[model samples]
Target chain A: MTEKSPGLFGRLKAGLGRTRAKLGGSLATLIVGRKAIDAELIEELEALLLGADIGIEATGVLIGDLESRLSRNALRDGDAVYAALREGMLGILQGGETTLELPSRGKPNLIMLVGVNGAGKTTTAGKLARQLQDQGRSVMLAAADTFRAAAVEQLQSWGERNRIPVIAQHSGADPAAVVFDAMSAAAARGLDVVIADTSGRLHTQGNLMAELTKIARVARKADPEAPAECLLVLDAGVGQNGLAQAEQFGQAVGLTGVVLTKLDGTARGGVIFAIRKKLDLPVKYIGVGESIDDLRPFDPEAFVDALLSGEA
Target chain B: MFTGLSERLAESFKKLQGRGLLSEENIQQALRDVRVALLEADVALPVVRQFLEQVKERALGREVVKSLTPDQAFIKIVNDELVALMGGQSEGLNLTGDSPSVVLVAGLQGAGKTTTVGKLARWLMQTQGLRVMLSSGDIYRPAAIEQLRLLAEQVGAGFYQADTGSSPVAIAQAAVEAAQRNQADVLLFDSAGRLHVDDAMMGEIKQLHAVLKPTETLFVVDSMTGQDAANTAKAFDVALPLSGVVLTKMDGDARGGAALSVRQITGKPIKFFGTGEKLDALEVFHPDRIVSRILGMGDVVSLVEKVERTVDHEQAEKLARKVKRGKGFDLDDFRQQIGMLNSMGGLGSMMKMLPGMPNVGAEASAAGAREMRRIEAIINSMTAAERHKPEIIKGSRKRRIASGSGTQVQDVNRLLKQFIQMQKMMKKAGKRGGMAGLMRGMGGKLPPGARF
Candidate 1:
């Protein structure tokens, strides 16, 4: 445990340190320790988890699991404690490694991007478009976010750089009609892929959410398997709140994958663990920078290693 | 625990509370606590320093309220300063532009760009009665186009998609053409986002700007992104000409530092805020209301606005003039004041708007309902003539009024004593500056009373 190089797990270790320190005071002290597990320790641990913003429901399940482990006399020293905690975490984290796989055989695998405003949905879409293009696929972009004044202009700029087509509408035009036109064009042109950029909206807003559902329905109607994948982009810096957004948007539009953006920006990326554990949503991509190539496909072992190892 | 924050604040306020006189040392210590709290809440360091400097300037030599402790007076000053720092009034989107005005959404990846598009679209269509069209220019992710299409349909707006071979610029140009052809009033372009602000992305966005010059280029940033959000906004400001900002994820447990920082750093008014992921969760940003909330005070600006709308200021002034002339403050006038206060979110909420007031939960405050009713009863029991002249009520009248109002004699005596004391205090304070001074005094005392 050198002071300087705490490895890839430095931030996680540091976050855990602060959480533990905050937990060390008053009521929390009575709940967790190196000694035998007790009711006090369980209650305190529960409080500690909730205080860490791990959320209420997840905290309950984690406490229950810990208690069962304790009752089986599986309690041990600090390393064992850490191992048990990791095991509990892994139960939620391990199986969600599948990336957004492209359709095996289709005119162009249409990947529909979605999320709340500021969730980096646009950036992730651009990065994913660039990534797919890099992988030797003919990619087309549809600037379906016709609501914002310069959104289409910005997306058009991305299209020019990538030498791809971006279907767009005016600043205040019908977004659904634009997508319908873009998809029809993509199908007719025999394009290998079409990535549509949607406007940022709240998952709870009924009308906007209904609009998203309608877009999916329309895409499917155009080609029964038109939207091969629906990727929900999220900000890594959002912590637990991002997970809640994921849950809502996932419920509303049926997310096929997730893109965790801004990994290089913050240390509180433990949200990945929480999202993986709770929502069971696969991390399809990881956005590291502003460059088009910065987007990379999700690799669970690499991610866990990078996160746990604390490497840049 | 959240109580840690509140307790720390209370301790600071305690230092400024009841003192025969306030010392410079006490003020410094209290300011130090406030600084620590602000910093801990993730306020930008520079903003905190600037805020502290402004507060220190305003607080020096200010008279402490007569009834309040020194801490209470200091807290009032600090609260007012905080409200000013956050901007005096809440501001909403200025959609008062020409029809089909362009509102550009810009931000880094994970900044909630797409969601804001939908929110703004719905707001325009529902609130402004404009036809909206949504388009996406993110060709990188195949799903991005489809996502925008789905959102457009959900919002009851038109959508567009381009062939992979066609350029995004061409698609955007064509989309604008499409909107013109359809006669849609508002066109929203959910532009592509990058992870970091890069040259290529900037050049590309700049090129798009060359083609379609939008009316408002809004930089969408995540409030939960903290300092990074501010930095990103700066980066985007350099790359694009931003007209306003859209802050998202405000519903999170953010101490609201980013909101303050973004406005201060960019000099751009926050156009809208995304409270939740719901389309309607988007709200126009109002600086004054946000300022009040940050100071742990309910929105006083709105309260004052409500009062201005409901209460006749001329009538209140006339009543005050009569009381000053020793004409006797009457129950009817008091009743009218109570009615005005009730209309303005009740006395409890008004009190919470004052500085140093502990935030009483709704349930605990509701427990005081009986006390309010008792006070109302005591005032209602007096005859019109008796109500007009408090001096006419003798000991027998007090007993009769107490019995009539279903209370003991002590209750009536307490009310009269309070009224007389208030009258004397008002007279001593003088006419012109008296009410202002009273309001300032009330600002200090309300906080301590709120604890009960």
Candidate 2:
């Protein structure tokens, strides 16, 4: 339901050349010479899926479905097998919410970005804020990530670059208080959205996670529906542990959705399938690289095709 | 380290364990289990295949030890192959050159390069007792240099500020000169995080590398990076003569399968692990420990080593002696004990090392740490009289201490009860022997107060 540039598939295909060789291109080889979906072809498909980091559990489910179909004499060729695989992934990825539903009140939609360390929460915060602003939402930035050194300045710089208002405190200030203050100020200023960039914390840190839930709770005092959207910012390159990250963050802050970043390289961002299988959160956005232009709404069709980009 | 349902792997190897030598069919079944384990652990598919092939070659028709099961013998072989691939033991920085040895830290964006740079500075300053300087060649990322400056200040290291708008090469040159002028023993140059596929950025790093001629070009990679870690590690190694890899964010739930991917691809030792957020949270990379972890077989040797390294033996002995002399264990001593627990990388770092450690995510350890911090805070709020003689902590004193510590009266009461148990346990352990006996006996099982 968001902007879809035509360059996405082409860019993703070019950037994901290595992954094509690892997953799609090799599978292309398997398909071109194959007579039918045999055991060896099925095995190669299994390896390709696993190689893409779609993870073992989801891969197992997909493979089991294929085997069951084969046993039932479905008589599927290699193309049918590939389409079935794509459809299976799309079954998991197709319907996730690409946008948040803001409340009717004039209160700002507080989108709190949370995730484990180095998942690019702060960077994604800036890009998402800019994207929302570009979409006619009067966006403001909040720097609640006071723990990391110079984190406030990072968000502040992003705001300065965008010519947007940023609410922040000195390093080591209580993050919840900063989040609340930013929310209330945004509401007072009648901003459409206030994106709060939270400090990256390991989901394993229970007390810190509790602090996040606290932040989510106290923001309601600023605006009744504050923190309307809590997005878990995840790195596309993260492995199977992305599931744990999504689960813990969702449990702690009740994340409304997830945003996968750093999709510019060979990392296929396949962990989202596993994550969606476990925790049924929608994919809100996907970031290609550090640039602001790289952030866009998640398009499952484009993503699935991008993975299998090279085909006759 | 392994996912649930991975109990022993012995059930699948029934025939292998029954006969001392494993049959090919049985070995294939066990290898299937191991293969699934590695895949679930998130090792790259190709790397997993390579690793399984080696394990198969070693485990095929291999005789098991009399005391060991077939699965255990096979796992031992798998663990050895992983360990040997990673490098046999802990490796430190190769800073054997003259003064102001340079180390360039590079990695993908958000892989914790800047934070690891801070931790590395603190590690160099403290462990080696060397004067260190920090500089950031990360001009592209906003506030990156400021982050390094703040970190340098936090770790008590000299910071070399590059001129405004200077290129990375100029920054490296200036940083080296400043280090020479300051007579700093080592200069850690933190570069901007760049994807290996970014040719321009890679080229820029190559130029910076030429300028620095770093004694160590450590690739700081996220432990959670999956199959892409191999491609990126190989690309970076090709772009630069990477001396080693520094796996960052190890304190998280990531199974660290990227450790194998990076090591196998780069053929470089992983030098350090940036364990936690703290500047002193860096740990020397231990291969056997990581191998056991990846293989889902925990060994107590590394745990004991960690305990020995972090635990203050002198303070622990003094506390025991005081308890023996009829001086009761006070709140202050309890606080010190909690501090010791924190210094030992908190509960999760230690918990993951125990053999047969159930899939206790870092949350359990974090909860224990939270409870310990609460106890410490409560003790801090207590009056000296109440702390020294907790018996005098009546209802009013309990309320006052609870309010001061921002805790409820019931929390205070629970702390007091758990403290009493700990006190009794300490007394019994004290009479039994020295701190070593108490540590070994009580270390695995933390005091009730610490366990929430």
Across B1-452, the per-residue lDDT of candidate 2 in tens digits comes to 33222333433444346565566777887888867766776777788889878887887643454426666677677667877888877779888888889999988888899899899888888888989999999998889999999999998999999789898889899899999999999999999988777778888999999999999999999988887887789889999999999998887767777888898888999999887898877888888766666545665887788787788889877776866653567887777877887877676666667776634555566577777778788999998888889999999998899999999999999888877877766666667667664574346336454443
Tens-place lDDT per residue, model 2, A132-170, is: 778788889989899999999999999998889999988
* Candidate achieving the largest TM-score: 2
For A270-292, candidate 1 gives per-residue lDDT tens digits of 45566767677877777655566
TM of each candidate vs. truth: 0.48, 0.87
* DockQ value for model 2: 0.48
Angstrom error at residue A159, model 2: 0.7
Off by over 4 Å in 2: A1-10, A13-24, A310-312, B1-21, B61-69, B293-315, B322-349, B355-428, B440-452
Q: Mind giving the per-residue lDDT tens digits that candidate 1 earns over B1-452?
A: 12223434666876666655666777788788887666444454466678888877766755553526666677777777765655544455554465555566777665677878888899889987888887777765445666677678778887767777666677777777777777788778877765333456667777666665677788887776533444456667777777788877775544556666667677787878876755776877777566556555555564565456556678666655655564455667666665555555455556545545546544444444445566668889998888878879988998889999999888887777766666665555435443453343223222112345
